[model samples]
Target: MSGEPEPGLVPEHQRPRHDECESVLLTVDGEQFRVCAQAGRPGAYDFDWLSGPHEYGFGLTNSGGLALSRDELVQAIREFLAEIDPATGYLAE
Candidate 1:
């Protein structure tokens, strides 16, 4: 959301358990969403929202072992955002 993580959503020291995965705080329409991308097996990525009770995520990778690009990551988060109704914190109709 802001430059800092939303209170209680993440601890200051919170880190991904897996070394291959990296996390970033993404802001869309002024709402903050944490996106984690795991460089799992070749040609696949494991994505998750490691921020709250309402989890929204997806993954994409190429069979050629291409890593998840920044655009892809943001797009994933955007899709997640589209599903959530910010006012009510529920799925958007």
Candidate 2:
């Protein structure tokens, strides 16, 4: 419950094999959770960590430059993953 993905839980596949850009990737507990807009600007993605709950969400811009620091992204992804509960499908709810 203290920010970690469930041990031995196989992460769900969170990506489409053939996306046409405009995608966001949420990394929670070492797993990739992604959502995307097929018609939006391709690969314009960003993420934010949800504190206290250990969850994160990603968004993709229609058309904009990518501006995410690697350190921040990594931290956010880890925190997001830690928030997920394989049994409940949420932040330890």
Best by lDDT: 1
Instruction: Give me the candidate number with maximum TM-score.
Output: 1
Q: Go through the candidates in order and give the C-alpha RMSD of each one to the true structure.
A: 8.9, 10.1
> What lDDT would each prediction earn against the true structure?
0.51, 0.43
**Local accuracy of candidate 1 as per-residue lDDT tens digits, 1-93:** 211112222332443455546666666556565555544555454445555345444445455665556776566566665666778565556
* Per-residue lDDT of candidate 2, residues 1-93 (tens digit): 122222222223532243554445555454565444334344344343333233445443333444444444455456545655757555555
Query: How do the predictions measure up, each by TM-score?
Result: 0.47, 0.35
Compared with the true structure, model 2 gives a TM-score of 0.35
TM-score of candidate 1 against the unseen true structure: 0.47
Cα error of candidate 1 at position 47, Å = 5.3
Structure candidate 2, residue pairs in collision = 22-42, 22-43, 28-80, 28-81, 29-81
Off by over 4 Å in 2: 1-30, 33-57, 60-66
lDDT of residue 51 for candidate 1: 54
Q: In model 1, which regions exceed 4 Å deviation?
A: 1-20, 42-65
